[model samples]
Target chain A: MSTFMQFITTGLRLGSVYALIALGYTMVYGIIKLINFAHGDFIMVGGYTLFFTIPAFMKLGLPGWAAVFIAIIVCAVVGMLVELLAYRPVRKRGNNLTSLITAIAMSFILENLAQAIPAIGPDPRVPYMLFNNDIKIGSFSISVATLITIVVSAIIMIGLYQFTQKTKIGRAMRCVSEDKQAAVLMGINVNKVIIITFAIGAGLAAVAALMYIAQYPKVTTTMGATLGIYAFVSAVLGGIGSLPGAMLGGIIIGIVQSGTSTYISSSMADTFVYLILIVVLMVKPAGILGKNIGEKV
Target chain B: MLNIKDLCVSYGAISALKGISLTVNDGELVTLIGANGAGKTTTLHTISGLLKASSGTIMLDDIDLQKTPAHKIIEYGMAQVPEGRHVFAQMTVLENLYMGAYSISDKKKIEDNIEWVFHHFPRLKERSKQLAGTLSGGEQQMLATGRAIMTNPKIVLMDEPSMGLSPLLVSEIFSIIKELQKSGITILLVEQNAKMALSIADRAYVLENGKISMSGNASELLNDERVKKAYLGA
Candidate 1:
């Protein structure tokens, strides 16, 4: 029973990472109706940012918390750069083909760039371990850092929800998502909203990456590639445009992986995940939270 | 007051709004009627800052609306209810209405405006928590109008509000529009249903292939044989 609890707790902890990464996918898909395949590379960039941030953090004699703050900021800027350079110019109609190719190219570019650099090339590993052992709660155990990350992830989601619900910028983003022409007629700057969407999505990715390496204690050029694919799967599982769905999908996927790995072959955990996804898709193509989308007649 | 002078809007090589001139006095409800692709919507789009005027001036009171960005046009007190009742489908009715007052920063004023929207759309009040996608077509139209009114603009532009509605709902929507005008809000209505639109309009313009072919009092244009054959389907 304790072992089962441990698996569940650990699954929930990893679920937070998937949830954060999934949000980036959902938000971009909601706003622009585009799948930013390069989003995973954005996560990789964020991880590297955290890596470089440690030396500066130590030089300033800052505590561990301060280092995280610096890392998040740097990662956010890197995300914005990806948007300005890679995504902005190809936003016109009928540019989806080029954009898709561009996104794939960008994903590989970020990965290869890290591989080419001597310091980070080939393989990357965390220089220091930031997390202590699990904190126990009634025999269910979870790491302190993982617990903090899960809590922080929830707070970020809440912040995102509030912004989308309460602010003008948020309203504009929704309007654009619903109908770009109508949004334009209502005096909304669609371009600005799209840029902001990319920024926020990138920022979330950065936070997720920071937590990711803190627990795993390793980083590499090719990091976040498989994880990025899974995050996209989570977004689809939940409903690509629905925020809550993304998080819920993440938790479900995490639970399946952890649950299966515990009782079955750990090496076949990925197969179980894919099997679940296939079954879920066959049952409901729009996803658990995703409604069937249609255009106004 | 609004003045659109010598406005010409083109989509690629095809002109959607030719060199057209028109004037609307303060506190006047005007309608533009035509068949599909007759440029009724284009005129409104250009005036509302959604589309740029290739060569023209769109003046509202003392300001040149043609030069302002689409996002800032609402600051000049003009709001548009786009074609087909374009409410944010995923948002709750209350959230949809609140989006209309996005530029109005005063919290109290925004609240009062929301209350006023609820008052104008009492049905919306009962369904405020409901997702806009779930509403009936008529209700969505009402919500769209209510959302536009929340801006408290001097003028509201609507494109085809009566489309895709039952006759009863059509009458219902038109009466509410009339009540809005009676309460002293200028309206720019673009429609394919010329007869219904002209009945409530103070003045009317007939757009033909991107140019104003006829302009006069609503009653006079309603009686015009050309309008009768082309738009009224008489």
Candidate 2:
């Protein structure tokens, strides 16, 4: 039972990070119908930002939380900058194929550019040990990092729910997602709403990065590229456009990975995640909570 | 007051509106009546800044609407009840109403407009929590009108308010249109139901093939021999 508990706790920690990243993918897709392939790279950007800032801040006698704050701010600005400079032109042209190609290109550019930069070279840098303690309940032991990740993600999710449901700007996001023309007719600045969406998604990626590094501690230029794929899969699993769906999908995928690694082979864990994705695609193409909207006549 | 002069719109090789001009004066309910493809809806769209005019001037009071973007047109006191009743299908009726007041920042004013909308369409109030997609055809039309009204505009552009409704619902909708005019709102109505539209309009224009074929008092057009033969189904 204690072993089972350990697996559950570990799975949840991984799932929380996945959920945060998946949300960025789902939100951009929901509003613009663009998959935003570069969303994952935003995490790498956040990690690198933290790597440089945390050490520098520590030397300047600032606490580590200040580094996290700066990293998040930097990532949010990068996300919005990507939207403004890279994505907006293609979106305005009304070319989905071009927008998608641009996203993929942006992803490559972000990853390769980080490697090419002298300061943030290809080598992996271990993050500052922010939470190193462990919490023992009964015979099972879990790291404080895991506990913080779960709690922080939950708070973020709750905050997101309130913003989307109760706020005017959040409502505009929903309106734009449903019908762009209708939203414009209702006097909504669709472009502004989209920019805000990108900013929020990127900020979430940064937070996810912080929590993610808490568990793994290693940061690499290519880390976001691999983790992005898993998060994208999670978004698809949960219904790409649905907020709650992204969270649920992340948790399920986490559990599956943990189970496979524990019972089967750790080497085959990723294979199982993909296999489940294939089955889901064949059975329910819309994902778990996604509504299959009929094309308006 | 609103005015359009020589508005021309084209979608690629096909021209939807060719040199169409019309005007709606303050506190008057004006209707543009025509058959399908007669440029009635196109005229409203051009005025609302949804479709760009090839070469024309749209003046809404002191503002030049021709240069305005679609999202900003409503701020100049123009709201459209679109032809097909384009309510946000996924949103609840109450949420849809809130979206209608998207430009307004005052929370109290938004609430007041919502209450006013509910007063106008009590059925909307009954189904306030319901998803707009699930509403009946007439109910959706009512919701569309209510949503537009919630914007608190000076001039309301209604495109096909009576489209796809039962006879009973049609009369109910027409009555509401009359009630809306009495409430001090200027209106620019576009309709394929020329008979009903002409009867309520303070002034009317007959559009054919993207041009103003005739213009006069609504009651005069209702009795004219040409209108009686072509539109009144006499």
Interface RMSD for each candidate model?
Answer: 2.0, 1.8
Name every residue pair that clashes in candidate 2.
none
Q: Give the TM-score of candidate 1.
A: 0.93
Off by over 4 Å in 1: A136-141, A293-297
User: Candidate 1 DockQ category?
Assistant: medium
**Which one wins on lDDT?**
2
The residue ranges of model 2 lying beyond 4 angstroms of the native Cα positions read A294-297
**Whole-model lDDT values for every prediction:** 0.83, 0.90
Share of real contacts kept by model 2?
0.77
Q: How many clashing residue pairs, candidate 2? A: 0
Compute each candidate's TM-score over C-alphas: 0.93, 0.97
Candidate 2 residue-wise lDDT, A260-289, digit = tens:
888889999999999998898788899988
Query: DockQ for each candidate?
Result: 0.53, 0.69
Worst 10 residues of 2 chain B by lDDT: B41-50
The whole-model C-alpha lDDT of candidate 2 against the native structure comes to 0.90
lDDT string for model 1 (A237-297, tens) is: 8888999889988888888788888888789889988888889889989888988846453
Model 1 lDDT tens row, B1-234: 888899999999999988988888888889988889989888988888777889989998999997788888888888888888888888898888777777777989989988988888899999999998889899999999998888788888889999998889988999999889888888888888889999999999888999899999999999999888887778
